[model samples]
Target chain A: MLEDIVLGLGMIFTPENLFWAFFGVACGIVVGAIPGLSDTMAIVLFLPFTYYLSPIAGIALLMGLSKGGNFGGSIPAVLFNIPGTPQAMVTTFDGYPLAQKGLAGKALNTALLSSVIADACSDLILIFLAAPVAALALRIGPPEYTAIIFFSVVIIAVMAGNDPCMGILSVGLGLLLSTVGTDPHSGSPRFIFGFYELADGISLMPMVIGLLAFSEALRQAYGWLKRQAEGREEPPVHIPGNQGLRWQEFKQIAPTIARSTGIGACIGIIPGIGTTVGSYLSYLAAKKCSKNPERFGQGALEGIAASEAGNNAVNGPNLIPLVTLGIPGNLAAALVLGAFMMKGLIPGPTFMQNHAQLLYALFTLLFFSNLFTFILGKFLVRYAGTLGSIPETLLISMVFVFCVIGAYAANSSLFDVFLMFAFGLLGLALTALKFNLPTMLVAFFLGALLEGKVRQSLAISNGDFMIFFTRPVALVFISLALAMMVYTFAKGFSRRRHTMSH
Target chain B: MIRGKRLLGLGVLVFCLLLWFLIIPNQTEGKTGAEFPRLIVLFLAIPGAVLLLRSGAATGAAPLKGEELYALRRTALLLALVCVYMLVIPKLGFYTSSILGMAAFLYCLGVRTPLQIILTPLISVGLMYLGLGLGLSFRMPAGLLP
Candidate 1:
């Protein structure tokens, strides 16, 4: 193993690999900085370009791309109060407020610093602990998978929103939406409403862009018009020049970064639970532990650290299940799965055993990609900070166009654009109701996976309701989930009683 | 405002009930398709019932104040415009429809400045053209446009 590691390190320091890693990171930053384009889209677009590179270099390029993209998303979220992707949504909670305070550069730098720290640490964890975790995960059957997922989601629902009922409502609604289109096992369409495009269920890209970006455009427009109604020209934004993170600021958020990185790495190994959930759960944990939790959603630097670190950290360990168990953790990992298969590297237990040297080389390349991200991120942060100076009206208008273009480009379908617009309306309505939109989106993301697991478990048991209890792992998780729900309800009930008396 | 929120809550309750009825007869190919959806809807009805029952206590939620109502109406109008924008895109093509949509959107957003009214759409269209034409190499949908 040591020899393999040594050999891999020696193979990775080549100029061609290093150059591709740098180039991939640079391109990824640009793609992620854009409102509609995402890391997944960037990889799909650039996959063909990696045909000639060695597997180590190719994977390295892809790794750098994802890392750069992870941090790049913060650029827009901070500047515009609009998340570039769902994974960056938590960043907007503190990021946009920080940008409003004329600290956009500082926010970007904090995001970058936390991203590097978490990503590098998580990569180390992936290198050392992947084998054991993968072995453990291999034992997780359909029953266990369903129980674990149920437990996690119930906790997520309970902890995510201002009120527990609203959180559950949002998650329920999301799961319902996920039931649209065809049932995966049945090949039967549920609620297509006669549209052929609904066959594949609702595409994630249109819904995400519509819910976050397009609705944001409309919201900004409304706010701008309201400002005009008040007969006040909006105050010009003050974009600071030297917006880099100071050591003092870094020191303050270091603990939050460390905590969120640990949280993110742990979540990363779980199949189908992606960066968005990791970031959100970490943000929740950070807020819960913080002395001044009220400052979190407003503009706390620690909020930025927790969110960026949590999301970015998942980049490394998310591949663990994919490479070791042939289980793609999320959509992004699935694409990486394709890239691996395309490179003639079939990932499973045998592949890991055989490609130990190459795997170590890929790991080495990823470790260095963090350095490239940090160096290049410094310069890009400056460029992103300048976006604050652009007129809100013009920027909003451009974003509107991009939202349309992005929706169309996703499948080259006008049907997607219409779907995007409909989701935009739904988003606006949810916002008006003050609903927990992120919970809905996340639940929607996880709903299909959860449903499939539960149904499969049932099928295997011949519809026996007690089968879950038969599996020790499943029994443990299901009990934990029920206890969590009961505990949360009890806690909320007591809190409400206390508040009413006060 | 309180009445509006009360109506919203009541509407949700009714919608869930209606959806429950709709799901009853709907047969799916997979064994779990109908069953899983039933479970989700049943879970959903709990919160739906909670909202309905609790609507009486929450009188302050999203009160329909004049400004707030106007904002909602404007948002509705924006949604309507987007629907129209979708319809016209296939008719007038992406470039023409996008420019038209942007101009109208800016107008609705109260951009009275002539320069902004003209420049926002033009600059946006130019960028879109470069992006679609060169970046993705996507062929423009030429409907009525040359």
Candidate 2:
């Protein structure tokens, strides 16, 4: 192991590997900051470019992409409340509020700091616990995964939205829409109504871009024009918060950051849950633990730290299962798994024994990539305020153009763009209905998978519902979900009772 | 207001139930295909029904003002442009449609500066064209240029 570490360290710090890693981080930040783009797409787009490079450089580039993209996603989420990726959605809860308070710089700093700290710590966890964690992950099956989804959805719904009923409705609405594509189990289309474009279910880029970014643009435009009619001819100039990230700010959020890092890292080691779940769960956890829970969605710094740390923490341990068990944790890791195969490296149980040097080398590059992200992120945060300061007219139209390009480019389908526009209207309606968008988007992301897991679990048990109670892990998550639901309802009831008395 | 919106929510829920339990089942093959959506729809209906029942008990926030309605109208206009832009892209190309759409919105929003109007479109379109088309190699929908 010592020999492998030395050899791996030798290969990683080479000029070629370092340069490509830097280049990858640069590209990743740009791609991730765009509303419609995702890290998975960025990695896929750059996968071919890695073919001619050495194995270390190639792998390093992808790693850097994942790492950089994770942080880049938080930028727009903080500044515009338009998350660049699904995981960054949690960032918007406090991020946009903080931006409204002109604390964009502070929020961005907290995000950057939290992301780097959690990410680096999770990398350490990966280096130490990849094998054991991967073993544990291997034991998780459809039942446990479904229970996890249930737990996550319930927790998010109960905790995040303004109204619990509305949140559940939003989730249900998302699930209803999610059923539009082909059935997961039977491979038959469900609600297409003869539209060929609906065959693949809904494309994610359009749905996400529409629900979060495009709808936000619409909401802003609505607010803008409304204010205009009310006699305010100009939008407020978004002056960034002058309180630069002081040590006191970092110190205050440090504990939350630490806790969320562990949460995110653990979630990442689990297969299939992915970064969005990790971040949301972490955000919920942070809120629950905060003394000022009511201050959470109202620009709490801990909120930004928890979310950014939580999502970024996924970057390291997401590779744990892929490296040790050959099971990719999420879509981006799946693309990396392809890169692993393309390079003639089969990543499984024997991979560690055979390619210990290469593994260590990649770890070395990961450390350097974090350093690059830190330096680069500091620079990006300085300019992030300007992004929000652009004229409302120009900004909204620009965002729209990108939305179109993003939706269209996802599948080269004009239908996808239409879907985005439709979902935007749906989002507007949801907002009007007092239903939060995050619940719907997160639920949509997990809806099909949740259904697939449940069906698969049922199939495995020959249609017996008792199997969920039979497995320890599955039972734990299911119980947690049930408990959370009851607790949430009870809390809401008491709060309503108190308010009625007042 | 809460009670009225509850009816709207109720109407949506009823439509959803029909779509999921009736229309969707007919389109699918077997129990496996329909069961999941049915389960979700069932889950949805419970909360929706509960919300509808409780709607009369709760007094929600104040209603929208006239300016708010005007804003919705303007926002709908912007949204309509998005729809038109999608349709136009297939025939007019991404660049042409995007430029026109951006220019249209700029003027509609009362931006009179030519540089701001023209420069925004040029920068936005060029950035998208180069990055999406060149960098990512995503094939645009067929149009006059492509």
lDDT scores of the candidates, listed in order: 0.75, 0.77
Best by DockQ: 2
- Which has the greatest lDDT? 2
lDDT of 1 by residue, A1-502 (tens): 6787898888888898898789888977876776555676566455533444678777777877888888888877887776766789999999889888888788888888999999999999888876666567656788987887676567656765556666677778888888888878768787777787888788766786677667777887777656555566433333535677778887889999999998999888765467988899999999999999999989999999999999988878888866775555665665565467557787754556788788888888887889999999888776764543456666666667777776776466888888888888888888877667666765776677778888899889988968889999999988987786667666766776676677
TM-score of chain B of 2: 0.76
| Model 2 docking tier (incorrect/acceptable/medium/high) | medium
Colliding residue pairs in candidate 1 = B1-B64
lDDT of 2 by residue, A332-449 (tens): 7756765676577977656887888899899878898899989887876666545444466876787787777766654667778888888878877778778867667556656666
Q: How do the residues B15-89 of candidate 1 rate in per-residue lDDT, one tens digit apiece?
A: 777776775336465445677877777767765565455422344454566665676677667667777877888
- Give candidate 2 regions above 4 Å deviation: A1-115, A126-130, A228-369, A380-388, B19-21, B55-63
| Segments of candidate 1 deviating more than 4 angstroms | A1-111, A231-369, A381-385, B1-16, B27-33, B52-74
